[model samples]
Every structure is written in structure tokens, then in C-alpha cells.
Target: MFSKSCNYAIKATIFIAQQSLQENKVSFVDIAKEIDSPTAFTAKILQILVKAGIIESVKGVNGGFYIPKRKIKKTFLVQIVDAIDGDSVFQGCGLGLSHCSEKHPCPVHDKFKSIRNQLAYMLKTTNLEELALGIKSGETFLKTL
Candidate 1:
């Protein structure tokens, strides 16, 4: 499971992606509302994403958060997760051990390995444009009804 910050980051990223097609930028308040996330927490997450170069921010009357044209090609879900929550979620032991490895496997190590690999693949391969298109085409749903 992802942490609250990760969840918010994903939501904010998707919202920005969806809006990118229509607008070059969006306000933090707008993103928070669209994702139903807390404004303060979402702001912090957005800052982290910006710092990670997963998202871009500008300051001015018309300035706000937006995905950089260049980053749209290089950034992936894993980077965002790493920026906000660190790599432990993806690399840590599945059974919450202090240390886990092939020689010291956890109870669910084998079972979790396949699933974890698949998730890593998806995160590494998927980018904001692909996710944005999914949102626009209804292939993905961002908000809960």
C-alpha cells in the first residue's frame, strides 16, 4: 500500500496531466479539489514532485503547477514515489523484516517478488502523457464517484 503522500502525489500528477492538454498550468487549490486531497498536504507533495523534476512550478498571477515538456518524457511513477516516499516501498522486504534477501527470505518473499516486479515494471514504464491520455479516454479513472 502507498502512503498518504504517495497517494496525493499520484492524484496531483494525474490531475496536472489531465489539465495539461487544455491548460499549461493549474493552481494547487484546483488540484486539491480535483483530487479531493487536503490543500496543505497536497501543496507539500506538489513541492516534492517539483523538486524531483516530476512536475514544474511557476510563481505569478498566471503561474502554477505544470509538467515540464522535457520531464514528460523522462519522469515516471517510480521517480515520483522515490521523491515523496523514498525507495524503501519498492525495495524493502515484503514481510517487514530488518533485512531480507535470497539467503534470508521472508515468509511471503517468493509470492511478493513477482507482484513487486510487475509493479516496478509498470511504474518504470508509465509516464504522465500515457496516464493523461488514459484519463482523457476513460481508460483510467482518477476521481471516485
Candidate 2:
């Protein structure tokens, strides 16, 4: 459903949002560990998120990453997906074909459209704050272990 980078971006953003709610900053190492992603790969994803204004990067001895308080509630999962994976998740073919459309439909095109619409709705409606709270309260988790 999402690329590895997008998955990490969502996890990292949720983790950062939780820290932001606590008025704390999170290091790349902490984010990588929490998300169960490689540090280098997580750093690359964070760079994208920072550039997209999804998260902030502080540069100092005590610096780390955190989402602005204003953004935590306003930022949608769709925005993070757009920043990391573009509109491909919403627009791309169900079978990964370059040109599968209604005119030239794939085997599962119609069925997939419904699923894609549901996913889009979910992404558009789910914001970072709610997801962060789920993690903060231990009702959900970013990593299996």
C-alpha cells in the first residue's frame, strides 16, 4: 500500500508528534529505533519530511527533530504520503501498470478503485495528533517488537 520510505515517514512523524506533545525533541537514532528502520534510511526520510515542512530540524548540541505544535493537529496522513510517495498511491494502477485506466482497465481495476478511495479517505481524515496519542497511550504501536 505504501513504500518503505512512506511507512517510515508516517512512523517518524507520529513519534515526533508524540514527543512534540510532550515538549521534547527526538533524535534520528531514537526515531530509527522506534520505527524499526535503518538509521541512514530514516535520516533520508526525515530530510524529505523536514523539507516539506512536515517536521522541523534543529541544529545544536541539544538539537533534534520535532513537529511544530500548530502542525500536529493540522497535518493529515495524506500530506505525509504526498510528501514521501506523491499521488501515486491514489492514482497508480492496482497492478503496477504504467497505463491502466478505465479505457484500458487492469484485471482488478474497478475493485481496486473502491479500495483506493477508502484509503484516500482514511489518509485525508486521519491526522498526526490522533495517531500520536494512540502511541502515547500505548493503544497502538509503530513497530511490532
Candidate 3:
């Protein structure tokens, strides 16, 4: 599972992507409210995403964060996760064993392997634009279970 920061980053990214279609930019406060995230935490994640080149930002009266429609194809969920939580979520052992590997497999290594591979594939294949479109068209569902 992803961390809170990663979740916040994805939500904020999706919000920005939605806004990019109409608004030129969006303020941090507005993004936080839109995604129901903490203002300060979302701002930090946005800064990280901007620094990673996954999103853009400007400073002025009209300054805010926005994802350029041009670079949408190059941005992936993996990049956002890495920018916020590093590669540990994808690379580390699912069973929490420090030495788990092919030769010295953990108890749940084989079972987790398939799930991990699927997760990695999803992260690599999904982009902000697709998610944004899903949001706009109501193809994506946002609910808490």
C-alpha cells in the first residue's frame, strides 16, 4: 500500500490535472480543499512533485501549480510515488524481511511477487492525463471504504 504522502501526491496531481484543462494554474489552498488533503502537507508534496519535474509551479499573484498539457505522456504514477516516498514501496520485501530474495525467499515472497508485479505495472502504465480524463468523465470513482 502507498503512504499518506503518496496518496496525497496522487490526489493533488489528479486535482491539478483536472484544473489544467480549464484554469491556467491552481493555488495550493484550492488544491488541498479540492482533494480534501491537509494544506501544508499537500503543499510539501506539490513542491516535491514540482522539483521532480512531474508538475510545474510559478510565483506571483497568478502563480500556482499546473501540469503542462504537453508533458502529460511522460509523467507516471511511479514518478510521483518516488518523488514522495522513494522506491522503497516498490523495491522492498513485502514480508518486511531485509534479506528476502529469489534464492532466500521469505514466507510470503512468492505470493507477494505477483501482486507486486501487477502494482508496478499499474503504476508504470497509468498517467495523470488518463486519470484526469477519468475524473472529468466520471469514469473513476472516489469513495472511502
Candidate 4:
């Protein structure tokens, strides 16, 4: 699983990518509305994304947030996760133990490690373009309707 901020970041990125595909930039207000995230929190998440090179922002009247059309396909989900949550999810102990590791494994360490690997693969392979397209097609969504 991911932090609430990271989840919102992913939704916001996908929304931005969808708009980018249509050659439009999106305001943080619109992104927050689409993802059903609080404005201040969304702004924080956007800042992190921008700093991570996962999204871009512009200033002035015609300015807003957008992912480059070309980068959409190349922007994997893992990048957003890393930007917001870092690599903690990948190496973190399943049981939330402070000193859990291979030799001093948690009760579910082996199984949890496998699950983490699969999740990492999923994140690494999943890209914003595909997710955005799914939303644009109305087959998927970032928030409850």
C-alpha cells in the first residue's frame, strides 16, 4: 500500500497526463477536485512531483501543471512512489519491526518480501500514459463517483 499523499500524487499525475495528451494544462484546483484531495495537500504533493521531475509547473495566467506528452509513456508509477514514499515500501518489514531483516526475519518476512517484489514490478512496469488513457476512456477513475 501507499501513503495517502502518494495515492493523491498518482491520481494527480494521471489526470495531468490525460490533459497533456489533449494539449491542456491543469490547475491545482482542478486536479484536487478530480482526485478528491484537499487543496493544500494536493499542492504539497504537486511540489514533490515537480521536484522529482515527474511533472512540470508553469506560472502566470496561462500556466498550470502538466506532464510532457513524450514523458507520459516513459513515466513509470515507481517514480511517483519514489518521489512521495521513497524506496521504503520495497524494503520495509511487513510486520513493521524496527530490526527485521533476512537473518532476523519477521514472522512473514519471506512471504512479504515476495509480495513486495511483485508490487515493485507492477509499479515499475505501470506508466502514466496507460493509466491516463484508461481514465480518458472512462474505463477507470481516480476518485469515487
lDDT of 4 by residue, 22-55 (tens): 9999999999999899999999999999999999
What does candidate 2's lDDT look like per residue over 51-101, in tens digits? 999999898888999988988999999999999999989997999999998
**Residue lDDT tens for model 3, 27-101:** 999988877888998888888899899899999998999988877766889989888888887776887888999
* TM-scores, each model vs. reference: 0.91, 0.95, 0.91, 0.97
Report residue 120 deviation for candidate 3 (angstroms): 0.9
lDDT of 4: 0.94
What is the alpha-carbon lDDT for the whole of candidate 1? Answer: 0.84
TM-score of 3: 0.91
Best by TM-score: 4
The segments of candidate 1 whose C-alpha lies over 4 angstroms from its true place after superposition are none
Global lDDT of each model?
Answer: 0.84, 0.94, 0.85, 0.94
Worst 10 residues of 4 by lDDT: 136-145
124: Cα error in model 2, Å: 0.7
Q: Report the Cα lDDT for candidate 3.
A: 0.85
Per candidate, the number of residue pairs that clash is 0, 0, 0, 0
Prediction 1 TM-score vs. true:
0.91
Per-residue lDDT of candidate 1, residues 1-145 (tens digit): 6898898898799779777766779999999998999899889899888877788888999999987665665668888878878876677788888788889899999888888888889989988878887888998888889
lDDT at 20 for candidate 3?
86
